[model samples]
Target: MLIIPAENAVNWKRPPWVTLGLIMTCLLVFLFYQGGDSRLLDRAVEQYLDDGLLELEAPVYEDYLSREIRLQGRSDRVYDLQAFQQAREGGEPFWLAVSLLSDPEFYQYMTDNRDLLLAPAQRADWLARRVPIQEELIGRLSAFRFGLVPARLDVYTLVTYQFLHGGWGHIIGNLLFLFLLGYTVEKALGPGRFLLAYLVCGVLSGLVYTGFSLGSQVPLVGASGSISGLMGMYVAIYGLRKIRFFYFIGFYFNYFRAPALALLPVWLGKEIYDYWFAGATGIAYMAHAGGLLAGAGLVWLLGKSWFQVRESFFEPDESALDDRFTTGYAQAMGSLERMEFELARHQFEALRQHYPGRLIVLEHLYQLARLRPDLPRFRELARELMAEAANHHQPERMVAVWQEYLAEGESFTPLEAEDHNRVLFASLRHNDLKAAEKAFERLRQLGNDVLTSEACRLLASEFDKRQMSGRARYYQQLMQA
Candidate 1:
């Protein structure tokens, strides 16, 4: 089963150039470092194979068996090197010997054999023994020097490790996730902060992996940890938003929409569950979890901190425009408070120019029209608002606007029979006698079915409360007829 995000639920103001640049860098590094499919993992696995040499230069299998048998509790069962070597060739002996090696217990062993197992010199020696595959020695030879190995970690490998990939599939999968999640995160944090956070998260992930894989000699390479950080940031920023994800289980596929934060626990839980249950599948789940935590922490700090941030790195900047718009909006509100009708009207007009199709601006203008009672803009704003509400399927909003327009002692706009009857019944419910009576007259003119026996009965009660006994009796007699 796989779940993939299609796009973000919320739209941001800027493009994701920083994310794009990161993807390009990862691709370039992959092509440059392992373009020939250097078979580096193949060579690493080969070193673990038994070569039938008990006493010889670099007896890799025998050295492994002696150390394993001595470290494992089965040391009493093995009497000599030959016996241990023979058992090492069998499946049962191999698993029993390597069990501790896969765990943290093997850390001391790897530390003691650092010169033979973890050093670049040993890797170079191994490569030298093989027939040169390429004339240019530029590829797998660099993984050991740059990749992060918990057993032999150099300070520089923390950042360098993220730029390397074990294979094309590894790099491609990481890049896909990076592009999907990083774009939104970069836009949220802006470019400069995004880059810094990414590198920091990657470093944190490497540290977490080092803590977990203490004795492991295999070099961890890939941008998954950093990309996981982006996923974390994406969740933090859009946590409350209802985002859509495409999910597939075998041949069945469907889409799910849920709060963006909902997936965070699901993802983190999966990683933790896999770490305990799935064993190692060449994946650094601890590193992924660490990066996710680090990214969320950094985002929280950045959002809540008092530090002044630099300008965002996206082009066609809108920050200044947004500030100006906010200031202008405040001024418009202040003008209304001061009863500067013409001034407020002018400000609302200016706002409408910038915020065309914005209902709030139109609403303010509609209020100005009602207060002035002479401006033709009131009718114009009313017509626009009603149409806008109708198009948006906001029937309640439409009723509200119509009622407000009628309260201004304006004629109701020509509406369909259903809408007219709805407004009439709503006005009656609110005890807006004047609006309801006007709506009723309009309904009568349209010859709608609104004047049924039930309607007449309800209107009679409302009329009797208002002391309109003659109108009440008129409706009552009509109901009888």
Candidate 2:
């Protein structure tokens, strides 16, 4: 099962600069810096084997494991070192080599045992060869050098490791989650608070992972923990507000509305469960859980520190746009009521231009056009009004108005070819094929191929809808012509 937020559509006004910057930085570091890790590991492994270190270290590593198990008094059998030799011969010691390299405890063991394991004559050669391998593994690899290692914890690595990724799938998945959660969180917290929360969560997450994986040598990399922090912050900020969530279980997927805070427990439980039952999948689930807790804590603390969440930002923006259009429309209508013809025309014209298909705007503008019937503006308004009314399935009312308009001394002009499609379709729809042909002929007379083609297509569709197959075919041919 997987779940993600489907909150209010993001306001792109601020452009999610920090989130985008973080993503770009991770991508660049992975592409440029982590690319050569395979080659370096290969070279280091060859050096380890060719210098005859694997033969000497395998049994010693077995002994180290045995002693650790004994100290803990666990009855777990030591995984035999026979696989190490077999792995070497089969060309598959990459994981084994990685295991040894990442282990500060094992690295320490090898250094301490060097004198005991090697002869006086061989010590110089062993020392010379092994130092390069140490540098290659612990000092050179991007993860070891920069990523969070529990045994060898450093101040800088907690932050740095969030930027380093292991491979393609790792980086892509992390970045995707980051973008999905980050944009909304950034908008909620504002950039500075968001960045602070992000870093603090990442550091806290690393600390939590350190607590869980104490004495382990594996270097943890990637933004899952920090992104997990964003997840926690996301819910906490929204709190009880019901938000949409996109969830998929097996092949079934859909969106559901739920209180934002309610999901925190679900996410926390998932991480804990995965960490417990999934075995060593190499993912840092503990860190993710820790990040979630840390992020929520940070938001809680901020609330206590006089930081009020901007509640208005979390609202769905559906009505915001509608209100803007309606407000402008209301003011235009108000101007028309006060007998300000010029002001109303200017206002309605702006609204009509912005909202071309708006029926009310066409109705009012068609009425206003009579004030200036001598102008081409009158014909343009007539075309727009009739076409829009036709599309709205109110062609009968507009056809009666067309007759009244003709009675008022307005005549149809064949030279005016613009926006003739819907009018033609309307005429066809009203069963007045003569009117449809007259409009189509006007469109053709102007030699405006674009208008003529669209008019033909509209007529064809209307005819086709009425089961007029021969008429539809004729129009389709005209379209090709």
Candidate 3:
């Protein structure tokens, strides 16, 4: 199931810096830090094997796993290490060696029983060997050091882990949701409170995951937990207000408007369901649920205090604030899409009446008018669009429109002398000799008085430039006549 809010396609207000910063930070971490973690971790593991440090820690890790650490069937993941017990004693497994180092509890046991586990010289060697392995695990690579591990349960890892990711797919999916939900939440809460709330939600989310899998060695990474918190805040901030949402379930998708607060239960239920059914899918559903609840709770608390909900956040942006023009233009475009050219023309005509300066409406009107050149609109629209294009020094488009009009119309529009002159000038300026010839021929048929001196001179000069001396002399004679 996928659900997204159908808002903030473009942010009308101040930029959401906190959200953008989080996204950039996550991207940078993946690119610069986690991008090369694999080779470093691999070399560290190989070095651990070569140094015979596995011989020192593997036995202790097995003994640590043997105790009744956790009885819960689903929770006793420490038993997963039992298979590596033989490898621990007789053979060396790279994965088992990694797991041995990753286990904080076993490391604690190794620390507590350091004297007993190794003799003076042997202990010294083991201590020296542990440095490189630990540095790679918890220092160089963010996965073990910064990533939130249930066994380690470090305080700072909760925030740091959110910035780290597994791979390309992991960071991309998480950041996409962040952008969709983050901007609005940041706007409503403002940057300072939003940042605070975000970190708090992530910290709580980590705690929830840690509580569920206390003995697990796997380290959780990615901003998904915090991103889930943004989701909760999104629905709750709007409260009973209806908001548009786009939802998809497998092959089907649609958009609908519903009360914003109503979606909280739906999101929570989905997360909880996935947590139970798809727990082993490597997705942290519990943390997601926890983040959601935490975010909504934060909003609820903030609401009780001095946090004021900005009702104007939903108002149209500056670019789209002209509601009537925007709406009428939309209707015209919709009609055009449905093959209702007549309706589209009528709508565009109405728009032109209200907004005579809006050339786009006139442009649309001209395009629709072409369907029936027999009507006066074809000539009228062409004249208007061409004249406007000429005045704006946008002669190229007028040349094309002039050629198209010549092909369609039987005669030039009567009494639109200024428009025709503009069209002719634009055509010649655009170097379209074909359109100029057609235009001049039509004017000549209407008799000598209709042709302007400038038109004849331009035609003669253009024909001379093309080395068509016969046509040039003909226009020159017309100029004298």
The global C-alpha lDDT for each of the candidates, from Candidate 1 onward, is 0.68, 0.79, 0.79
**Candidate 3 segments whose C-alpha is farther than 4 A from its true place:** 1-18, 59-79, 82-92, 113-125, 135-137, 148-158, 184-197, 203-220, 242-258, 269-283, 304-307, 315-481
TM-score of each: 0.50, 0.65, 0.59
In candidate 3, position 114 carries an lDDT of 86
- Candidate 1 has an lDDT of 0.68
TM-score: model 2 vs. ground truth: 0.65
Candidate 2: where is the Cα deviation over 4 Å?
10-14, 62-99, 102-104, 112-125, 304-308, 316-481
Q: RMSD in Å for candidate 2, one decimal?
A: 8.3
Task: Candidate 1: list runs displaced more than 4 Å.
Answer: 4-14, 36-140, 306-481
lDDT of 2 by residue, 147-194 (tens): 898988999999999999988999999999999999988887777877
Candidates 2 and 3, the one with greater TM-score: 2
Write one digit per residue (lDDT tens) for candidate 3, span 1-481.
8888775564555688998999999999899878788877787778878888876777666656655344434434444555677566666589787777655556666766889877888877877778656765545677877899897687899899889998899999999888888888888877887888788889988888888878766789988889888888888888898888999999999999999888889989999988876634678988999999988888888765644556656665446646888999999999999999889988998999877778898889888888888788788778778788877788888877777887786454452455566667677888877777767766666555755676899899989998999999988998898
- Alpha-carbon error at 176 in model 2, in Å? 0.6
Residue 465 alpha-carbon offset, candidate 1, angstroms: 83
Residue 447 in model 2: shift from native, Å?
A: 29
